[model samples]
Target: MTQQTLIRAAVVALLVPTFALTACSKSNQDQAQNAQAQLQQANKNLEQAQQNLAEAKQQAAEAKAAQEKQAAQKKVTEAEKDKAEAKQKQSEAKQASEQKTRQARSEARNQAKSESKPVCSDCGTISSITPIQRNAQHGSGVGAVAGGVAGGAIGSQIGHGAGKTIAEIAGALGGAYAGNVAEKHIRKVTVYRINVAMDAGGTRTVTLNSADGISTGTRVRVEGNNLAPLH
Candidate 1:
């Protein structure tokens, strides 16, 4: 070929190769940028997922805590019920025991009176008289009065300001009922211990339901183990 033609052909060849290389480079750069964008998007998704997982864990923990608190409250309520039931059972048992004791005492007293002689009848000079205030007693209507006083005193210290009034009323009601129950079901009796000196010889002790119509130096009648003052 001619030199000019050869030179033109060579120039064309160089230009075509340069253009192909530039196109390939641009395509590779675009692919790389796309890959970077995809990577950024994946990282963002991962961060979001992580946050969601953290929130789920927090919710789970809060739910567990709440369940535990409810369970604890339920246990407390059950415990209180059990305590109340136990107290009721105890009170019942005490009442039964007292009844049994009373029956046995009555039977014993009857047997003793039948067998034992009425020694030193109407014998005895009352040496001393003592008056005792009985509180834990049955059959007197004293329980309600005592209970009201006690409950009021205790309730007055329970709350402050306006709430104290409400507390006092509630306490008084509860205490009154409790006191009545205790008196009827718990306390067997209360009495005075009387001692007597017999002119016939021998000192005797007796129990009286009340101190009325009897005092020191008072004349009394002795029947078996019992004693009564003269009218």
Candidate 2:
């Protein structure tokens, strides 16, 4: 309780003695009655203050409980979001795998049909084989053009007058040849270029990425652009 409440209690305690002394004198009966009334009012104010404190504690408890509940709900919501993302990723991976399988089978069938035979899922057998370098960028003549330009620039820097013109022409020719060679060296990959004789008596040319024990007369299967040795 407050200091005012404690002081009121002290004053009431003293009033009993005070009243007795004044009653003995019997000269101030009305003043003693006034003290008693004030003591009662102070006691009432103390009780009201106590009641207000109890209500405030209850409200604080309720607020804390509500905050905890909201945090729990938020955790649950975040967990659900994470679960949904994982499920979506798994579904995408499954679809991609299935699509890749279908494409591989379709490509194999097309390769089989290249032999003028009925389209099938496999690509026949190896009849004749050659080890060849395949350059991804060489067939378009872009290399030659770039090479010629670079060669002419170099040639123009070298000699003077008529000799410079001859040098440019010679450099261009040389550069074109070098560029073609450089492209083959830079972009070429080694593979066994094989002619496959289909079981259906039609021949198809196939490029296998590696020899991998495959040779002339070796039977093989084409799954998409990949080759597998026949068992």
Candidate 3:
């Protein structure tokens, strides 16, 4: 072989190995870049999942708070209703008590008025009647004096001296006593006594000069100190 031909063949052998090594290096770099991109995408997906879980927890907490508030409002409403009912019952009881007291007072007043009225059907009645005789209270001394003078004159004519004087004194004394008694008998009075029975519970007596057609069992009305017949 020629010398130039030998040199060209050796150079060609060396250049072929260098080209294969460079192609292998380039392929490894491309695989490393693809692995890095996949790692970044996995991290982003984990962050999004954590954010969604936090939002779900917040929503649950808000719902629980709303339920508690509704329960508290219901309790307050029930308490207010009970208070109103109690007040209404108390007012009704007070009114009923007042009405009962007024009725009692009215009944008492009516009873008092009825008790104070007078009973016209039972006032008084005539129980009995009786006649009475009464004598004069007294006589004047003029009757005795006149009787003594007439007796003395008659006795003086019967005798003389001392005997006639003794007879005149004795006769005058007897005639004076008889004349006083006779005057009293001549001045007698007659009266009637009436006894009345009162229905209010008592008795009364009345005196009259004559019986003016009054009798027992007759109903009468008692005035101050007098009695009048009932029709």
Best by TM-score: 1
Each prediction's whole-model lDDT (CA):
0.82, 0.80, 0.80
Against the correct fold, how does model 2 do in TM-score?
0.35
Better of 1 and 2 by TM-score: 1
Candidate 2 lDDT by residue in tens digits, 18-83: 998977777566777888899899889889888888888889888888889999999999999999
Clashing pairs in 1: none
Each candidate's clash count: 0, 0, 0
Scanning candidate 1 in windows of ten residues, the lowest lDDT window is: 130-139
Models ranked on TM-score? 1, 3, 2
The candidate scoring highest on lDDT is 1
Where is model 3 more than 4 Å wrong at Cα?
1-32, 108-231
- Each model's TM-score, in the order given? 0.48, 0.35, 0.36
Evaluation by TM-score, superior candidate among 2 and 3: 3
Ranking by lDDT: 1, 2, 3
> Candidate 1: where is the Cα deviation over 4 Å?
1-5, 116-231
* Least well predicted 10-residue stretch by lDDT in candidate 2: 115-124
